[model samples]
Target: MLLCFMGSIDRFRETVPLAELEREGRVQTSVDGRALALFHHEGEIRVVDNRCPHMGFPLSEGSVEDGVLTCHWHHARFELSCGDTFDPWADDVQTFPVEIRDGSVYVDPHPEPDEPPAEHWMRRLEDGLEQNLRLVVAKSAIGLADAGVSSDAVVERGVRFGSRYRESGWGPGLTILAAMRNVLPDLADDDRKRALYQGLVHVAGDCADAPPRFDQEPFDTEDVSFERLKAWFRENIKVRDADGAERVLRTAIANGADDAHLAEMLVAAATDHRYLNTGHTLDFVNKACEVLDHVGWDHGDAVLPSLIEGMATATRAEERSSWRQPVDLAAMVSETFADLDSLVESGAGTEWSPPASFTETLLSDDPEIVVAALEDAIREGASVEALAREVAFAAGTRVAQFATVNEFSDWNTVHHTFTYANAVHQLARRTGARELYRGVFDAAINVYLDRFLNTPPAPLPRPASSTETDLSVHLDELLDSFDVEGEVDEAGRRAAHYLDCGGDVSLLRERLAESLLREDAGFHTYQALEAGFTQAELRDSPEEVRTLLVAVARYLSAHFPTRREREQTFTIAARLHRGEKIHEEGQ
Candidate 1:
């Protein structure tokens, strides 16, 4: 036994006798509430925090060989002396000063202030983003967020890093940030934190492996007018010349072009090719604007350039008329465009709500009637808000009516129509830009054109009378029987039953959303399901709500087929390892 004495403050305190630790290779002791592992390696004493930084596993149980300490759980290795981890996922652990005092081991518990907590964590965030280390990224995000760092700072940093590191420019990660940005406002407090973390993760991962980007020099003109810049931007985007477009945008920004002008230019380019890229290019551009709002306009230099790249690289769905069969969509859409101005002017001061028949008019296979009815409603004094809501619902119906037989990629077809319409609806409500209404008109035209693509057409349940079934129980049954054939019809009927019984549509919607979230559905499912709910929320009519819910039920039931159940192989292996009968007692 060793008699140890406490030293002055800031001095190392004897933790354990070296002779006691000689029997084992290491010893775990606490000094001032800090746990540390003291190791006897090659006659030299080394000390480090006992907790593995990876998952808080006690490092005292870890193996030390060849100057490396290895965690038994995940095989994370660290240099015993420096405490640097070889695994990026497991962050470097803190090492303490070791002192030998009278055959006893002493450890200094106080950590040296190598850097400020905020700065150190900020650097870790960069490393996590660069390496695509999920746990490290999450920890850094949470730590930074808890330290009162704004997500704006994190986003600005990510935008700078991503733009500089990826030579090819914005990729899916940028798009992902753009995509997730819209959901932040709708998320709860905790979920908002998660959303921020996810957005940063994508931006970081996108730039991780790529080389630095060399931005094109701004056109050497000091006085490029907003109009001329706008003209050039539209032209370059139209021709799919990303370099030309980026220069025009950058030059415009440098010459004092306001974000409003930049927005108009992007919108002009987006609408130039009606429903471009099934509306995703436009949606992405809109999301980019949202990113600007979160991160501040200073990042526009890098962020907007990526948007230009998206515009240049997008595959415009409007260019292809292959899906316009059974109807002359080109002619129908053109006629509707001619009447848009007169319709808006006439409907400017009118007080009207969309008739119950608007859904039927929308669902009708005739593009001409649909367009004409929409214009008539607007001319008859239907508010832009009402019109927006109507068209938005029709777009959701297109998604809901889409059949799964259209192949995996075909989901985009309806998704484009729905998202495009939803974006226009949202923009109209926000800015009341008449041009955005035209987007709605274009979406409607496309929706009408896509009516036939629903091949087996969505099965809308036509229950004779709404039954008195508990909506919650019905939803549960719908989920339970999702794998069985004809379940889509049952789902529709259940939806109808709930609507008839005067159920809380929002509750039912929440259930549906929860089911999708739990099932690990794809992106398109989320887009479609969410669009339908948004449309439903905008409407004032119960009948319209019923129709929307039925469509949602049908869409989800059709797309989300039964996942085959399987036993866990690890469980089977464990059973076999226990000495249980191998191979079912026979065979």
Candidate 2:
């Protein structure tokens, strides 16, 4: 029996056990420092190279089923006995001779022959890439043709160029062809004709390592056929063939064309279809509106109301069974409203208001209809306040049921926070509601403080020079809202404990300054310092305030500053009493 060992078999035996191969059905072992796959198949022990021929996946770790080993990566299979390729699409792995002698399995220590040339492998890769591209283009073209485009012009154009370009290897040619097909109905006839010619002539010249630009820009388009096609489409077909042309184009577009390009095609089809068939203009408009709605056109006020009125009239004219009537009407109205909202957001058409007629319809006696209308409005970015008021009024008049404030809040959070915040701020400023603003400021401060106190100290906001004064003012307002006495008591306890624990006074002073800087100071300079001091030992407070107050006192003593300034005088006195003295007046 010959032992086929490639690398250090000792290292392989150390990582995996021999018994694991028998019990587990397969075991990956490295022998002679090379990976080896060991498994029992058909009542006989077998071993083979661990690496796959394709992509170098470890075969030993793969599954063994019915004498075949399957590579876990990419599902390439190999025959364990001969190391022959089992998967027709993939290459084969190397086989090694193994035998069991004296109750122990032995492997031959010899490497397999060298792999094929890089050029040979590259040719295969290029072929595979081209084949995949052809499949994709063919499939897409067939789908487009099936969508009622009677003229096979688009597909023929694709095939002609696709075949000619495939010789150079189909990568660049397939991409251009796919792009053309996606935008065929949308592009002007001249552009489509040019694109077809470009695909054919694009990759000419340079058999050996050609520049990519040759593949990108086709030879200067002076070909008479290309020029003739362009001229015919421009002068003759565009004007005369508008109706017949648009029908084919729209069919191509509806049959899985490109999204951004198909929008223009649908629009053109709608316009031409309406003009050509006046009796069916309303039907064409409805279909076009459906497509526009799908594309999320926010039909600002002008287009949406008209579309909704049209849909309403259609619904009334159509009398169908219970099942179809409600579903169709609901779908039409919903789609129209959605398109209207999209149009509004897109800034399309003129700014539109909800028409009185439609608003009355929304407030109709039928609860189901009203509910459906409200849902559509909500889906389209209608304000929460507007929706809620409508619901409330509707419910009061037995038109519809109302929703709760929590529901409105939830809805607003998802859709209307930007509008709501701006509106609230505007109201506060216009009404001069300082108290209301103060309440909001306090709430914001509490939220920030709660987050900071619970979470780790985050990196502080980079201090801004101009904004520092504004921050100080806000800090003061926040401080005024706090219970100073209660905060001071807590600070006193903390200070007493720190002193008892032998903490340095300088460290305490630094901590107090940091706390002051970190505190949410809401639009009031003095209150910011007050809030900081209320939470710190008075003796540990910063000297800037003391210096400022001392200057204020000297000015007051020099000239009696007003009663408004008396508060500043008293504050300075208290600081001085607390052993925080200023060195110089106004210095």
Candidate 3:
């Protein structure tokens, strides 16, 4: 039986008769256009949103047992009294304050005064982390930001959970955070939150259900020699003994090892092994240092050890046939190491036209010859910086030049070489350590290793002369032709034309950004865009920037033929956020 509506001006409307709720155990009703379920338990009535948070199922059809309501669809359960969910993916439903007056039940239909949004969302973030709830994680990140929590706080929360939960050390989740963080300042305000959510999704997803590894207490040493500690650190790191490595590092820091020396130690150890962990180990090491930089160095003792653990456990990329075979690239890499000092000394610094020259050697398909040419160029006074710049361009070219392959995953195969080379370029630039030349050599060899992936190479457009037609007008037409091979060939040609007509390098950056922003992009595409911007900043001459941008144009044209699928995901999330129902109860 239904009761006549009555309240303080209809604020708390009578929902259902107490006897009907008690007998039926639960009842469904609508209050001010909102679906709600009323349940009778232990002589008390509880009311909550009737639509399941997971898929918006009608909770009226759900069963109430043992103080929990289980939605039939997907079996998501919520507490009858509090509306808290048993599953993170389902999310907690909203509960309304309930009242009883003379055989009648009433609901306020408005949330009671409670915790602030920031605190609530922060708690939700913790729950999301605990249950590895990706959607919840994203929603909480956005919520926290909207509630005025600092990005640093949000980042610290994730880092704390990631470092604690993933005992084996920094993995792809943390790496994704590190990488995307670089692009954060450049993204639009809304995109910054999206990037943060993207990073948190990975971080939480990574540590979900992972066994926690306890960190060992730092060694209490007062008088350890810096050299000996460094030596011990390298040895332990080599053996993948994280505890021992941490003790050594802690001891060295205790003995007044500044950031520069510590950085040198990391760089030394990173480059000590050839392209350690197929170059990712070194990249992780760099990123870990960067993380320490992001969060105060005070947290170094806690965070840096994870990187050591990651390096010690990582598989050597050189061991793979893809990196080892045909060119005997590893041996060539070793040979370059033997004469690195001489090569650096030999460079008298010359303006060798980049990227064009670098591309020629990469296409030669001979790792030894490429190394020999690099040494010769350095010996002939080609600045190491110049070589580094050209190397980055060549790396981008590898991506831009990639022809269609049967394996879809090959995109990453090619991307790894580019990223590795870019990493080497960045690290070498940062430390200016002479030994990093070996890293440059490793990058070259990997480039050689990827030679076959670019079968049926796309032709690069030539540099344009003054008075060439404005290329911006054809942007859409060129992009439209991107999906079909050889159809978007004009993209490269237009890039050349733009560069030839004395176009500002900023325009290159703008065009690349425009092309990417026009469609949804995956991680690789985002990374590629970052690499292009990084190259533009690192290079001096217009020619270098032009080569990098042209490569970007070619790569985007080839790789991004259609809008990415993430667009639809964001769209659905928006609709649901606005309180719109997405799917029918059962259909």
Best candidate according to lDDT: 3
Per-residue lDDT value at 29 in model 1: 85
**Pairs clashing in candidate 1?**
none
Which order, best to worst by lDDT?
Answer: 3, 1, 2
The lDDT for every candidate, in the order shown, is 0.69, 0.34, 0.70
- Please list the residue runs of candidate 1 whose C-alpha ends up more than 4 Å from where it truly belongs after superposition: 1-14, 29-35, 42-44, 55-58, 72-74, 99-103, 108-118, 151-172, 185-213, 220-222, 323-328, 335-353, 377-386, 401-410, 453-521, 525-587
Candidate 3 TM-score, C-alpha based:
0.77
lDDT of 1: 0.69
Model 2 lDDT tens row, 1-587: 23335653421122234455567767777666566777877786777777664545567668878888888877888877777765534555666666554455666546445543333333332332334322222222222233333223443333333323332222333333332333334334333333322222222211123322112221233333422332332232235443333333333333333333333232222222111121122222322233233323332111221221122222221233321343444344334434544533543333333345543444343434554454455445444333333322211111011111223222112111111122222223223221222212211111221221212321112222332233333223223323242232233334333333344544443333323222221112212222222222222323222222221111112221123332232233333323343333462
Q: After superposition, which runs of candidate 2 have C-alpha atoms over 4 Å from their true positions?
A: 1-24, 52-57, 72-74, 86-90, 119-123, 130-587
Residue-level lDDT tens digits of model 3 in 1-587: 33446442445777888989999988999988888988888777889888887767788898988888999988999988888888877878889988887888988887663688899889988888888776677677767878899777787777777877887778777776766666566666666666677677778878987987686765687777766777777788777777787777766666677665776677666666676766677667666666666666776666666777776666765677766665566666776778777776766454554444556886567666787788877777666455665666677787767765536567676677677677767766666656566667767777777777777665566655777566565454555556555453577666767678766666555555645643555556656666666776776777667667766676676667555444344444445555677666552
Q: Where is model 3 more than 4 Å wrong at Cα?
A: 1-36, 40-42, 100-106, 109-113, 186-190, 225-227, 239-242, 253-260, 314-369, 376-387, 405-410, 452-456, 461-529, 536-573, 585-587
TM-score of each: 0.78, 0.22, 0.77
Provide the lDDT at 450 for model 3: 71
lDDT of 3 at 51: 83
